[model samples]
Target: MRPFQCLIIVALFYCPLSAAIILTPTVMPLNIDKGGFAQFVITNNATATLPLEVSVHQLLFEPDGSYQSATEPAATLMVFPPAAMIHAGQKQAFRVQWSGVSDLPASQSFFVRFAHIQLTPATMPAGLRPSDTGVNIQINYNALLHVYSDRQRADIVLRVDDEGSARLTNLGDRFTYTNRLNFEAIDSEIQSQFETVVGDQFIAPYTTLVVDAGLTLPAGEYHGREIGF
Candidate 1:
């Protein structure tokens, strides 16, 4: 048997024949301000020209692992002209944003996924279909929830001098620091939340943890030290 065949037999995952389609961003688990926007680039590797669809959904996972979901409607972008099309050797970009919906919580974590996408031409002829027709893309983004708290808490407080900074008074009282902190970024067309992990230093419980960068931060109304755990 072929090497790929043997691996497929071992894994029990079927492989498709069409050329693979890939999506990439300069940075993923990409950080954006709560009410901010981010742009992503998508590239096609196949020789045929194709039209595409995109959509996004948000999922809220509680500390206990319970969850809720919000899915968006299907969206078809402007017809990709043949010359302006995503050729086998070319790439294109699209913009995505967080609507600033108040339902998101601060200092929390959730999953964002892409769902319901398929490729088609701006218009297909009556009886012609590309060998690579009907291909689909699915990807997801996993991000953290952030909220800026104004009220004073026993363990948490805002910094006096630094902007967008917070003070953590005592970490041992609430959070058990994890050796590994993992985050994920969602791609709407692919319906998958891909993970990316980063390293962290000491996050003092009572001392301050300054969050200066406006990235995928847990937004709004989190309990003191709840995020530490």
Candidate 2:
């Protein structure tokens, strides 16, 4: 399998509109040893019943800080109830399980997408009138799924350049989840110290992340701390 690399911005929940469908716990982590199963909840807040379709894709990250996904129907992961009908103000639960090899060499990442299926006049619920004067909106959500083994480890190295920029490299076989990065700079002539912090980021195995520390200092010696995995 190819290594996945991306800068993941973690969010608590997804709700794009007032009457949109809500998905909770956007990040799902599964352990391969202990059954490798997890569940997520989806709540329908719209006025009409929602028809949803679920699909699984292998998440891929590009060097240009973009994301792409490829469908893997024959993969080890399984999603229960690939299609669902959730009534307004009702909640549905979906199950995801890893049924692949028992001994995974490294961690894997996937994106489980929940998309709204448009309702036609023939498919609309009984007594529900199709909106003719108002705009209809559809929202889709993608939740991150991380499958890992107990022996997974992340080796991240932080390097600072002379121009006050920073680079993070992950040499290990697992993904590194970093919340913050701290760096200190010293100005010899002014005898002053400066510190900068970078926001949350993810570094995948065998990938390098170039980021700005958000601080510019005179040419001087600088040091940084490796982000905790």
lDDT of 1: 0.32
Give per-residue CA lDDT, model 1, range 1-229, as digits (tens): 1110010111112123132445544223322334344555556665555344444333333322234444542131111221235565577665555444333223221222222123344323335344555544332322222222222122432232333332222322222122222222323321111112212332322333433333233333223233423
Positional deviation of residue 193's Cα in model 2 after best superposition, in angstroms: 11
**Model 2 C-alpha lDDT per residue in residues 8-88, reported as the tens digit of each score:** 332223333323657876887788888899888888777777788887777665543345668654377888988899988
On TM-score, the leading prediction is 2
- Over 4 Å off, model 1: 1-19, 26-35, 66-68, 73-85, 101-229
lDDT of each: 0.32, 0.63
TM-score, candidate 1, is: 0.38
Clashes of each: 41, 0
The superposed Cα distance between candidate 2 and the true structure at residue 169, in angstroms, equals: 0.8
